[model samples]
Target chain A: MSAPGSALIEARGVSVRLDGRGILTGIDLDVRAGEILALVGPNGAGKSTLLSVLSGDASPNEGEVTLLGRPIGDYRALELARLRSVLTQANAVSFPFRVIEIVQMGRNPWMRGSTVDDDREAVIRAVEAADVEHLLGRRFTSLSGGEQARVSLARVLAQSTDIVFLDEPTAALDLRHQEEVMRVARGLAAQGRAVVVVVHDLSLAGAYADRIALLDSGRLDALGTPAEVMTAERVSRVYGLEVRIHRLGASGRPVVLPLRD
Target chain B: MSPRIRAVGLTLLLAGVVVGGIVLSAITGQLAITPTEVAGSLLRAVGLDTVWAPTDPIVESTLWFVRFPRILMGLLVGAALAVAGAVMQAIFGNPLAEPGVVGVSSGAALGAATAIVLGASVLGGAGIAVFAFLGALLATLLVYVVSRAGGRTEVVTLLLTGIAINAFAQAGIAFVLFVADTASREQIVFWQLGSIAGSLWSQVAIVAAVGVAGVIAAILLAQRLDLLALGERNARHLGVNVERLRLVSIVLVALLTGVAVAFTGIIAFVGLVVPHIIRMIIGPAHRGLIIASAVGGGALLVLADLLTRTMVAGAELPIGMLTSLIGGPFFFYLLWRQRRRSGGWA
Candidate 1:
């Protein structure tokens, strides 16, 4: 409804091939700042692959990607690192690093000649923002799945990048923690950064994303607001399951439920 | 304590221990020179006027020609192995990875074997050193190239590749020994067992130059290595050139490993254990880990060499055997404790 915000990232006719197998094909998308774009799809639908290409984690075999009007491949690693940060689904640290130490790693890009005082302050602020200050002294390997996820989020937040790509950041969290994580994403978007979240939960996507891009077999099946994309017919057709879209009266958010024959 | 202060303190402490180990190693032998006199002789030999110097020609020659070169070799080899281990662990993202265990040292051994048995020469005097470095770099590159898939390397792949390469290199060494004359065969066996017993000043000088350069390069790459531990995808996102980092790190690891192995033979556990011990004390920050591992490794080898020399009367143990005998148990302890704490392999 609001005029689309300025495009921060543009992918034109992008495709990815690995080991002679095509993983993503002809995906043209514009990710705009001040918006949360949720990529939702079934397993093996290439949502993660698309996110990787957008975040410069994987190079596309065909087509072009530009971030902030420059080809993604043209930017230096350090320069690109200052502009984007990615939170991968798996965060396994081999060493027993402290939680604060893990979060401090986020400041690595800015640590060139930066004082220790500045680093400590940035780490503390990121910890508070991610609400993981209580776990600061704890070893990362000692933390629970949810706690580690939050600490990892804090690490990404410490990067202070403009474009954030989070791949299933709430996959290990409880309902409350899930909401907390999604709230952080929304808050980041509100601060004028483009946030792309790859998630399996349609309800969370519906609640937080300004637009949902439904992917099926490496193609964009549908892309729009919840009401425009989450109709029972399209949901059933895309997911291959009968479903009902229930609208929450107060917030008018669509919730999808599978219907029995 | 602040990490900066802690790092500085740890560096100073390790430096003191290394110096102490060198002095202890220098004085305690069959001839039995006094520790204070040994120090004075060393300082005086280096043109520094000291309060005490060995007046006897035998003592002076013993200090400079015999003990000093061997001790210096031990120090350089120890430092090189440990620094290489730290860099390998960081690059491979595994605590257990090391040059000897991962076949890089054996690759160097094979190259050195070719030079010794086949009489290959590349740089006249530095022939063996050049071949060993080339062999080490090639072997590591082979393992890395084989393990990497889709722009990422898996630790399991690295372990597996290392095992295969190590076995292959062992067979190659065995073949070389089989083809050698009786005297050459004995020399090859002694070399394989790894001892600094016959260290020369020329050998010490070569290891020192190469080892110092490799160690310094590893230290400089420390920050990038820390970023790389975040996984390749995440590291790339954070503006690290993952491919470049991996390439440079492997080359440096090979250079360090090759130089140490060329001089000392296949000293296994120093590279594997020293870094792990330092990580336990100082945590896994490579910036500090690299420096501490260098000093700690040097001290450890000096101590090991001392053990080899003194543990038996008139007959010294092979340095490699002593390291493995000590390092194997220490590795198991670390593994068991880690399993108990994490309840899984990290």
Candidate 2:
């Protein structure tokens, strides 16, 4: 049980370097429960790297992360896993596993050493929640990319963790599917689960995210509410392109658009 | 039938086939014995006073001293190789990742060659087997160490390291053969081809001990293996210590493969083929896969050995050769089918 408004995951002075190239320089951020925080950046801006660091998939070279008021390093792998679930950019499985089977994998941590009494129920709920019930019996690889993306979401959702990290969950999706993904993120947040998403679609982030953290060249450019952060100047400065901000109808959230050169 | 019941039924059927194969193998030599005779002799040997008459001297001697040991060794080695293959496939998350893919067979071959050429009688009659096991274990360790970095094993590094080590081991074997006398060279070549012809009760007991332990350990790892199919990051998120699991699986595979090759020579393809076929028939769940593979492997090898014994008049083909001959085409067909579905090799 996490206290609302307190950071579920906090990164302080986190830095990462891979293969002697700096991927993420010193950075600080906090992901509080009951909110959806979208990380938006240009390619190679270290958004995914930062997400990995915050999720404890990869440790930072220099700084430490704290999760639920405890140092991330102090928590065992299984303990961290129980609190957070990550949906990575690619959910490629080489085998011909069924969609249901893939979603069932999300319950592995809980099912370990105990009878899988509730796993079926959890999987069914997640499948329906993510709108992947139709894809249940099909082989995972046989599905279209958008369907696979939704199924992968179902897997992460089935994990039922308090903190969820999704990297481009709607990348392959059509417009409607993309909105459906954002709606699911909103649903998770409404359920009091913290959702962290990395998205290239600025409009989607603006529409769905409670807060948007804009990153540029491995640095945090802005961190505030979507309207506060998606200003025309900051958008152009970070993306190196002149842009305009338009308010979507009744939402008060600003949509970012690039202007013609 | 439900999937669960079908799996159980398949497992029982496989076990029965293995038992039948073993019994048939035990009685299939030049001195033929009926199944009733095998049961009666087996019962009487266990101190049960059977109603049947006493067996002839030559038949008794052949059955107890020679055939039974060979049959037992075949069963143990077959089960060990297939189970090891299944574990390797699970850990690597690839159906093609067999024990031999990591240089264990080549390393064991080099060890056997060294033992034969140098006449290293350190362990007396068991010297070759001991050296072979050590060689296989060392090769597996070398591959693990070379591929591992910062507590994670890169898949590409593992595959490349295995290729490099295997090539190096082949050079070592070539050198050993070059230096050995004619008789030792012949012995080395024959050993490389693999045979259960000279299997002794002592060898059977040793292989059985290692094989049984490895299979049990592999079976216990089935649940974790299922999680691993989701890929490494996903498996880690599911509470599996991916690095530790890989290490344990590697060591167990080495033990199973080393012991199997030590006693029976480089019996190729049993590990790779048996598991693949079982997975096709019973699905890829490791719980059923492990048990089915063990039984299926034993049955396949026992039948292969029987074929080797009876295929030609007063001659025998290498058991390893037979497996490879059958398995190579089946492997190609699997790849072809996968290509047809996915439109390309993954």
Candidate 3:
């Protein structure tokens, strides 16, 4: 068990170049346990790439990512799978597998371990958490885009890993489901898990994430609480749009709105 | 019916059909033996003395030396091809993928043809089998490498790659036929058409060994294959070694299809049609799908072989031709359905 507020995964000066173009450069970040870390950026800003590098899906050209005090590359696929789960942007299933079957697949990494007995309980809890119990019998391919996103989240949740990476998980979701997904992420963090999410919607990230990391041109532009990073000047300058920030409700969550001249 | 019940019912139904087909195939030829006589002879061969065992030498010899080996060959080859098809579909993540459609059978056929033409007899009786395995391996690797762009295999690209490989393999076979002697030319042509007319026990033993082993290996891979259907990256995230699984499955497909083709020649579409239909009946949970496919494929070929022998008066039609006649239209139907759904040749 990792101590709360300690880094579950730490990246040191990570740099990635693909096709001779830099996707990420000299980035340092830590995904600490018991918090939601949102990677917020404009399109083509390498939010997903940074998430990929941190999740072990992509290796950096320079620097290192360490998970659980060991280099990410040192872990085998199954070992990494047991330690972390990733929900990619696209949720396409080639065959007509049912939703329940897809969720059950999340237990694969645990199958070879003593935690095998927890599979059914884990799947049931995940299905409830993502509110996908109703869609269990339906074919994955037959679901709507929003429904697919939730079901994919259920699969990620069912993996029961300490660290989770969700890349634009709410992109195809409705407003209600988007909030539900963030609440689920919060619930995971409440249970001492580390969550790293990429969000295109700045306001949603401000409302839910404990700390926000703003990326601009593959560099870490800002890293702090929503109020500290969601300033009008930085948001407008990075996104190339004049944006107004408003503190809302008792929690004073920053809400970013594009300024209309 | 519940899925579990349906799966169980389908398994029982396929087993019955395979057993019935085997018994029917054994007794339906020119031999005037009864089912009881076939049973008794089988029993007696296993050291049971039964009164119903045929006293006539001709009937006994025909049953053991002729019909039994042919029937066993059909069963083994059918199971092999269908399981190979299931494995191919799993690896490629496309239902349209098949050994015959993807040119694996033709490649093996070309290898066997070359072996026949070059008089590879000095390498022992298994020379054609070895060459066929090599040819199928090369074709499988070639198709896999060329058809995949990025990580996924697009249906159009896979089918087009199949077409290109099929054309190349057919030309190679033609060249082998052209250079062969008059006697070897007849053998090559006959082998290309595919049949089990003169199957021997030794050949049956080889196909049986390879086919059974391949099916077991495929069943072991069933769970990973189900994960693979979620796409390559997703499968990798779930702990499946996608590249290693693809490699092992490709070799398994080549070994099974190669040995089957080495004996029965290019028997078309058993792989495609059988596994697809089994998947439809049982859903795509590969363990059940593959087992049912092996049984269903064996039953289908046994019955088809029976039809080939008796469809015309004393004329044996090529079993491969009969299968293509049916499977070709089924493939078209599948393509049409996929087109209507995806709204293009995606």
Candidate 4:
């Protein structure tokens, strides 16, 4: 494993085009261990697309992604799965599998190796972490949207991979669960896993992410600490709306809000 | 009850039913034979002489040649169709997916009809089976390729594709029928009705080999099939080679369905009803569901074949007709329940 601050995955000059339209273009980013990197952008700015490319889910039309010093394309699917876990936006399961069963599915990649021993403990930890212990016996299909999202998050956590990608993990959550999800992401990063999150809530990203990459029109408009990348002027220009930034808490995390007359 | 205990209990119950059906079928044929005679004859064939063994040569011959082959054929074909249905449901991630409903059976029937119409004796006795396998494979591939859109198979699209393929295969069968002579046409029609009457040991052996191999392969793939219920993209994320898994499963379904169809014509709804009922009892895990479906299917068809033999006082009914007669209503009930739950199919 790489050191805590070392790059776990690197993308160089990545571009993605779908149906003859550019979804991402000339993007270069590094996902390092021990930090939560939030990809924040307005609608259609390709935040999720970039996350997909970085997680080896989608191949970029141009450039390459390297994971653990090897070309991402060179690794077989199971190999990549052992190294990364992805929680997609949609968590719909066709069958009426129980919640515990779904979470145990996260251990599937490790089933063939000695690491299989970690399956049970990892599932228990993830269940507790995602606060889905109470929902274990319930059918996944019977859960509400927010409950489904948390159960899905527990499954991802149970995978116990070195790198984690969460796409809009808080979209369906209420305020408390939203904060809880971010805290889980923070906990993942603290455990020395690289967490890449595609988020719409700028304040939550700023509060939890060690670094923020602001995307505009499929390009990386700014990349730095929250205070630097989340300035009001750039945020306003990119989002086409006036916004104010307030620094709150002892850590001085930036809170962004739209300036409505 | 826990799923584990439930699976074991169901399996034992199905086994008892299968063994009972086999004995009942052996004894109640045109020539009456007692259960003791059936058991004693079976043991004597294995070189243990008993007074209970049938003394009449005709009784012994009837049990050995006629009843055993038909009973074994029912077991093999039933298990094959049910396993194929379970695999198809897992691969498509939809409970409604089944070999007969999705046109694989009709496609095999069309191919078998063609082989008979063309006088395929030059290709050896296995010509019809070979042709049926090819037809089933082609139909399965066609349905899979045509029905999928944006990396997922919608229920409506899948059913519509089945209808189109079934229509095309039926037309092909009709043309072959129009060209055939009287004897061949009768043979084709009888086969289409789906029966194991006068099944030979050689035919039973062939179905046993293919059915057993296909069911074992399906069991080995059970875990990966479970992952597929998460949808194609998520399954891939979990390290499943979704495309390869789907391709292999489709081929496996074709092989099982084709072999069963070649012998029995087109036994409908055993695939659909058996697996669905098993899943409802055992939950959606493919390992338990596939094994239970196989056992349950074998028992179902054995009992159904027994009913066909005994239902008419002096005649036999087509096993396929019996299955469809019951299956049609069960399928309608499932559709109605699904509609009520989902608030109508969009």
State the lDDT of candidate 4 residue by residue for B195-306, as single tens digits.
9888989888889988999999999999899888888887888999888998899999999999999878999999999988887787888888889989999999989999
How far residue B49's Cα lies from its native spot in candidate 4, in Å, is 1.4
- Backbone clashes in each candidate structure, one number apiece? 1, 0, 0, 0
Query: Where is model 1 more than 4 Å wrong at Cα?
Result: A1-4, A17-22, A113-121, A249-251, B1-5, B46-51, B120-125, B147-160, B181-183, B332-346
* Each candidate's fnat: 0.70, 0.50, 0.70, 0.76
lDDT of 4: 0.90
Worst 10 residues of 4 chain B by lDDT: B120-129
Q: Candidate 4: give the TM-score of chain A.
A: 0.97
lDDT of 1 by residue, B1-346 (tens): 7566677788899899989888888889999899878878878878997778878889989888889899889989999999998898887777777888778999999988777776654343267788789889988888777876644445557668888999999999999999987866777788889999888888888899999999999988988888777677677777788879988999999999988988679888787788887776777888898998898898889989999999999999999999888887876786677567657653
Candidate with maximal DockQ: 4
Regions of candidate 4 where Cα sits further than 4 Å from its true position: A115-117, B121-125
What TM-score would chain A of each candidate receive against the reference chain A? Answer: 0.94, 0.95, 0.97, 0.97
Task: State the fnat of candidate 3 relative to the true structure.
Answer: 0.70
* Candidate 1 C-alpha RMSD relative to the actual structure: 2.8
Cα deviation of A56 in candidate 4 (Å)? 1.0
**TM-score of every model versus the real structure:** 0.93, 0.93, 0.98, 0.98
Q: Is candidate 1 or candidate 3 better by lDDT?
A: 3
lDDT digits (tens) for residues A145-261 of candidate 3: 989989989998999999999999899988898999999999999999999999989999999999999999999999999989999999999999999999999888999999886
lDDT by residue for model 3 (B1-346), tens:
6656777789899989999999989889776679998998999999998998999888899999999999999998999999999999988888898999999998888888888888884465488888898899999999999998656688899999999999999999988888899988998888788998899888888888888999999999999999998888888889988889999999999999999999788898999999888878778888888889888889899999999998997789999999999999999999999999999998
Per-residue error at B93 for model 2, in Å? 2.7
Candidate 2, residue A37: lDDT = 96
